[model samples]
Target: MKQLMQALIDQGARLIGLVGLPPMGCLPAVITLTSPFSPRQCNESLSQIAIDFNQKLQSELKAMQTDQGPTIVYFDIYQPLIDILQNPSQFGFDETNIGCCGSGLIEATFACNVGSKICPDPSKYVFFDSIHPTEATYNYIFKKMQPVIDEIIQGQ
Candidate 1:
C-alpha cells in the first residue's frame, strides 16, 4: 500500500491520503465466523491485528513523508468505529452487533439481495450488510475524518 502511494507521489500527486483499516473483529461477518458461542460479540484477536497493522501503517506513512514527498495524511478509521460500536446510542445507532440485511448475521454482497430480509430502519444499524457499513455509519466516519481531510486539502 505504501509502495502504491509512493508511486502515485512519484507521478506528480501532491496530496496523498491513506485510509487505515477498520476493526475487522467488530464486523458482523467476522464475528459470525469466529465466535461460536456468541456471534454478536467482537473477536478481540482479529481486532488486535487490525490495531497493530494500523500503528505500523502510521509509522511507515510518517517515515515516507519527507520534504520532497507529497503531503501524506493517514486517516484513522479504527478508533472512531470502535467508539461507535461501544456507544451506539451516542451515535444514534440502535444496532451495532448485527447488520441490517438478511438475518443480520452472514449476509453480504450477493447474499444481501432484494429477497433478503432487511431491517425496517437502516439508519438504526451500523452495518448494512455483514461485511459493510451503512450510509449512516459512512457519514459518521466521514465526519470523524473531515478534519484530517481539511488539513490535507489546506496543505497543512
Candidate 2:
C-alpha cells in the first residue's frame, strides 16, 4: 500500500486519502471467511499492520505539511470511527457490535436491507449490515467528526 501510494505521488497524483479498514477482521465478514465455528479469540495475535504503515506515511506528511505543493492531504477515517464505536451512545447508538442485519457473523453480502429484514430505526443503529452504515448513522458520524476535519483544514 505504501509503495502504491508513493508510486501515485511519483506519477504526479494530486490528492490521496487512506481510508483503511476499521478493525475489519473483528467484523462479521470474517466468520464466513473461516466459518461460524471460528472463534474471535483467534485474532489475538494481531500485527501492527495499518498503524505502522500509516504512522510512517503520517511522519512523511508532517514533514511535507508546508503550504506548498498540490495539497498533500490525508484523511484518517479509522481513528474517528473506532472512537465513535467505543462511545456509540454519544451518537445516539445503543449498539455497535451487533449489525442491524440478522446475518450474524456472516459476510456483508448478506447485509440488512429493504428486501432483507432491517431494523425499523436505522438511525439508532451504527451498522446497517455487517459492513456498511445507514445514511442517518453516516450523517451522525460526519457531524461528530466535522470538527476534526475542520481543525485540520483550518490549521493547515
* TM-scores for the candidates: 0.93, 0.63
**Which TM-score value belongs to model 2?**
0.63
lDDT of each: 0.89, 0.58
The reply for model 2, stretches above 4 Å from the true place, is 1-13, 31-48, 60-68, 110-114, 144-156
lDDT by residue for model 1 (1-156), tens: 777986797799988778898899999988888884553699999999999999999999888889977888889999889999999999999999789999888899999998988999999999999989999999999999998787766865
Top candidate by TM-score: 1
The residue pairs found clashing in candidate 2 are none
In model 2, what lDDT does residue 141 have?
54
Residue range with the least summed lDDT across 10 consecutive positions in model 1: 31-40
How far out, in Å, is residue 131 in model 2? 1.7
Alpha-carbon runs more than 4 Å astray in model 1: none
Error of 1 at 101 (Å): 0.6
